[model samples]
Target: MTNKPTALPARPHFSSGPCAKRPGWTPQQLATESLGRSHRSKLGKARLQHAITLTREILGVPDTHRIAIVPASDTGAYEMAMWTMLGARPVTALAWESFGEGWVTDAVKQLKLNPTVITAPYGELPDLAAIDFGHDVLFTANGTTSGVRVPDYDWVPEAREGLTFADATSAVFAQPVDWAKCDVLTYSWQKVLGGEGGHGMLILGPRAVERLESYTSAWPLPKIFRLVAKGKLTEGVFAGETINTPSMLAVEDYIDALEWAQSIGGLTALMARADANAAALDAWVRRTPWVEHLAKNAASRSNTSVCLVLPGLAEDKVKAIVSLLEKEKAAYDIGAYRDAPPGLRIWCGATVDTADVLALTGWLDWAYAQVTAA
Candidate 1:
């Protein structure tokens, strides 16, 4: 009953992080960017400003919310928020996967903050219903490693006591975030959008700003992590001014990506694209009994980084199938995260075409058959 797939995917770049670039992207597209110039110069400033403006317009962030492009990737943005803001209140760190667990470690081990740690194993969600919103909450919007995402913000009470920080590096653009319930959200350009890495974007709602001005961490703050001075928020950081030197080339590539986002509609369209891409693969998974989604709850499953668990296959068999697919140039970097349970992790973000996803499934089946028959 096994037959090789007749057609190949038109595009096969699908790494979850630094995911596939916008269709037809090449080095030639960056020809007009400011090169070897100071980011503070007028032309560079305008380019950076354009990126910030389009981001705000497309994402529909609140008027009071502030967006900043900072050094390092999403990790820097998240760590900045944690170092500057977490000690303000008793914190609640939630973890169902690796990135979430990283934040928990930062809270308890690094900052030495006494906080409540709530956790769940892979393939299951933490008890979102039981979290005490009275304390400052920290959670990832999507678990890139395990492929679980919070279905919605309805679980959080409206008039809760403390701020909510969301590490949404993999969630933005692919999933709709209810920012009304969120205080601090952080992401990098390299995720949903196929932009260059090396920078992070931090979006701060009104309450998040207020916390920055009002609270000070007991631990020593590094220069890069400092977000306040003279007991007031550094407002300049939000207005295209960065805390450190940023890659002008990366800045331009991001601008191009943002413009591409605009041309295709806005966040609504981007999310729809990701959903459709995920659906294509999901349909195939439903018919394939050997594999199932890593996220046990259907509602909690991620549409972007779709993780799948092989029911009874050994790790070596899964790795061999991954190697076969890679050797055939049918898929790249679809292996599950190293720490996560043995499985396949596919990127179905907006940048990924549904046709490619549909094509990839055949390759998966072919690889599985090749491994099983041997």
Candidate 2:
């Protein structure tokens, strides 16, 4: 073996999710006193509330939105919105990739709700004109699996009667989100924030909050999924007062990540870093032949989960090369999703440096040549 590629620091984690944390991350930043304590306790509640406040401030969420630090991960946040809002009317779901398809499946099958699914091939988004906002709408802000994203909120209907729920799990922090366009927005700590998995941050604008309060669902609200009670907004739950106990450790990790984002000049600076990193890889991708981006439209592409399809390679051979890359530590978790065609999925989110992306691209050039030669 030439040289075990320099290990990713002690914690140079580059997994697409539960990814590498931001620079200057430290466990000492966590308040140890809140660790073993009950979340309902005064100290525990304070820490939790602080985390909610800081995250909202970092993301530029509006004052009218209620942010909840929920028990489940991003999945929980999405499910909560579905259960609370989906039954009221017909649902139009736009699915372009795996995660988006999952939400559509949930709406049509799991939730047992009436729905219309408008789908595009893996690399493309649905026709925006087909979206009927007269009914409840569900979509993913960023398709984590395909590296495709909505270019902007301009396509969303401005004169819509129903609510819009967007799962922005991979897009938040890495890009700018227009809160005005979404009624319910969901994310997890493990994505851009690089915190431990387990906590879901659910942001509900006033319209979504009103739906939760006024709407009556035919199904039971799982203790973990309940968002409102007796036609009233569950204000306590959004204030770090959760319906169930949460992982203090994970919460602490999220706090550290948010503080790091703030110290580096908040969302604006973070967006610039993420865009620059993705652009570095995009420049390389444009020049490289073996790997091409899976996204069809450059404008609709995602800056965070940048996926590539290795054209002309046997799928099995691609898998073998991916294993070799991981063993070499040149790249890890770059394999395309199981449902997707064989390729590479590189995380170009803010936490990952532009220099590292360039280095990775250089290694990719070398690896592709080696694999093809074999």
Candidate 3:
């Protein structure tokens, strides 16, 4: 193995969630104009609306879609959609990782919906052909834990009778989502945009709106989950009228991130940046002897959260390597998800620099050698 590299990544923030901030980001970079002001004020609401508009623009969302800043992060957005729109049809919940499994738990235990659950082990995709699209389908677009992603939307039947609810928290902005196949899509700013947490963005297409207008759940709907009132969709919710108070600071932070996205040429540029970061690691993984990508298939490998499986290494040894890396200040929060098979999880989202990812591979090699030599 090579000697410990003298050079370190210029930036080492690689946590999958609450990912590294946009390039050149600093706390002072955020706009303070919206702080200390009522969220209901014209300026504050405009800020929220601007975030909504910029998000749509960057995402290339359809004109027919309704975008809302919802309560909580991506989970809240998913729950809101499930609570509001399921039971209209038979349900299908697909799982290949922890987050996908969480949706299954909600479907079977909490919502009490007798949905068909199709799943696979870590680092593999479930049989997409076996899915019953005649029923409501809920799944995560990217498996952040397993380093697996549903390759594309080609598997979703075009003539299906159900709506597709995609939890794209880790995929949006970094991956191109086939909006034509997705009806209800949700993401949080903390993922790709590198913004503050506590806010979720929910986008509804025509079919989703149709379900909201036509279907009503038998369960009790909390005020926060209520998207309809007096027999009509709450238009104001999509227009930046939030159900509860929101942190204006988080709002402004998201706007700043969105502005950064725009400055870097929007979604296309963002995907390229993330792809470059992942490619840097991929090039290294190709030559690495002791470790490999957790994702077994190249087609399903995620570009945003690149999980790696140490082929012959013990999980404890992997943890020790991670601890060593952290102690050396070479990386931080790079451990695999607790629920996932033990390995390494690196953030290759757009906010992370490609140079840093390249530098990280060298440290991984050094750390691996150091651990094994002991």
For all candidates, the clash counts are: 0, 0, 0
Candidate 2 lDDT, 210-264, residue by residue in tens: 7887788898878888767778887899898998889988888888888889999
Per-residue error (Å), model 3, residue 13: 0.7
TM-score, cand. 1 = 0.98
In the predicted model 1, the residue pairs found to clash are none
In terms of TM-score, which candidate is strongest? 3
- Model 1 clash tally? 0
Instruction: Give candidate 2 regions above 4 Å deviation.
Output: 1-12
Give the candidate order by descending lDDT. 3, 1, 2
Candidate 1, residue 147: how far the Cα is off, in Å: 0.8
Candidate with best lDDT: 3
Worst 10 residues of 1 by lDDT: 26-35
Candidate 3 — worst ten consecutive residues by lDDT sum?
1-10
Better of 1 and 3 by TM-score: 3
What is the C-alpha lDDT profile of model 3 across 61-125, one tens digit per residue? Answer: 98899999998999999999999999889999999999999999999999999899999999999
**lDDT: the better of candidates 1 and 3:** 3
